[model samples]
Target: MLQVLVSRKIAVAESICSFELCSLNGEPLPPFTAGAHIDVQTPAGATRQYSLCNHPEERHRYMIGVLKDPQSRGGSQAMHEQVEQGQTLTISEPRNLFPLAADGKRHLLFAGGIGITPMLAMAYELSQRGVDFELHYSFRTQASAAFLDVLAEAPLARHVRLHDNAAATQLDAATVLAAPTPGTHLYVCGPSGFMNYLLSTAASQGWPAEQTHREFFAAAPIEHDGDQPFEVELASSGQTFHIPADRSVFEVLDEAGIEIETSCEQGICGACITRVLQGTPDHRDQFMTDKEHAVNDRFTPCCSRAKTPRLVLDL
Candidate 1:
């Protein structure tokens, strides 16, 4: 963890706020990519990841924007009420999995609500590189949308279209995502419902899985039907253990005195990722891409499982 100070705080939008953070000694922090996020240690010791929303070229500081989540499990509320400017904060180094890959000549960007934060940085990076891209920004209304002022002045503003759900007709998915084009990449970040709808619609139109990328802030719970038991073999330690359906892999491992690092048991945070040396893993997490899971052979043990009667993990 890195020690930092909240240099300043400003209202960037109606429900969105921006915090300019820097090291207490004003030293340069570690360099980070455009879509990276830092895990901030809250006053309650609850760590929450917030995307770095500012230009990475700026060497002096990091900027993080937070939207007040009404259904927040206390983290957002504590940040708004207790976190003060100039206060010292502990933050983890930046980490990025939602990186922009060069798959095509043209890019279509889609963002919903606070999901616009990371896409805002991507838009800036693409503009700097002179990449052809367009942004489709959707929000409940103008007041609730963040970064409108800054985005309006950007050179890429000509390619951006903002939709206000309150006044204008809802964004038509068909109008925006009509025909699939070759050499065009689509990026989406939003609520689960919006993401599911967009991805399903795009897939129905014959968009290949590789042509699209996404980032999600919330993940639904994993559901299991019956109490089926399974066995897990730790490759490194050469130990095998039974994992009952009622208990998660992490819980069983901890009970057996096997140590592994973990943070978000819910799977939104990619902390507990481990390699699946050999097994058909019944993946239940949201941190990894379907392709990544298939090829990389990594799994989040906190909430995933093995479909095979016995599985081997490189823990």
Candidate 2:
């Protein structure tokens, strides 16, 4: 656990708060690229992941924005109500499941609500490098938009577009993702419903899967009412564990004294993904692409389960 001090905290929007964390010893923090996130150990004892919104060039501090989600399970609420400037917290090094493609000639970014956090960093990087990119950020209203003033003063300000639902200036995903251009890449981060709409629209518009990328802030609730008991075998140790319908494979492994690195156990993060030596996976994770799931060569043990009664894992 890397200890860091919260140097600053500000209300960026109506319900969003921005935090700047610096190394406890005043040393440079771990380097991170755009679209990277760190797992923060909250005061309430719940771990939460927040995207790094500061430019990658700034190594002294890591910045993140958090929305006070009403449905939060204590993380955001703790940060909002209990955490303050000068507070020290434990955090994980940066991990990126959503990375910008380096080869794209033209980049199109879409951000919805608090999803703009990662995009803001990407915009700064692209602008500094003089890359061709455009950002379309949508919010419920101007009052709810975070960093509007900051964006307005950015070097890429001319390419930034803001849409407000209350003002009837909503983004048309269909029109924006209508056609695919060679060497053009698209990235989106937003609510599940908003992301699904963009992905489906891009697919219907002939956008290649490789050129389209996305990140989810939270995993959609999955119903496991029909889950069944299954068995997992570790190929290296020849040890087997039985995972009950009510428990996850990760929990079963932990009970057996086997541990794995994991964040966002809901399958949004790929940290707990393991190679599958045998058996077909149910593939419930949103981290991997359809092609990766079709191969059935890898699976997230945190949330995914075996389609077969017994699964052989690389372990």
Over 4 Å off, model 2? none
Off by over 4 Å in 1: 225-227, 254-263, 269-271, 290-296
Q: For residues 1-315, could you state the per-residue lDDT of candidate 1 as single tens digits?
A: 999889998887786788889988877888887677888888866788888888767668988888878887877667777888989889988887677776668888888988887788888888888888988888888888888887898586887888788976577776777787888888888788887778788887878788888877887856788647899999988999999988888999999999987766777667788888787888888877777777748888888887788789887
Model 2 TM-score (2 dp):
0.98
Q: What is the lDDT of residue 91 in candidate 2?
A: 99
Best by TM-score: 2
The lDDT, on a scale of 0 to 1, for candidate 2 is 0.92
**lDDT tens digits, residue span 204-265, model 2:** 99999899999998898888989999999999999999989989999999888898889999
Instruction: Score every model by TM-score.
Output: 0.91, 0.98
Clashing pairs in 2: none
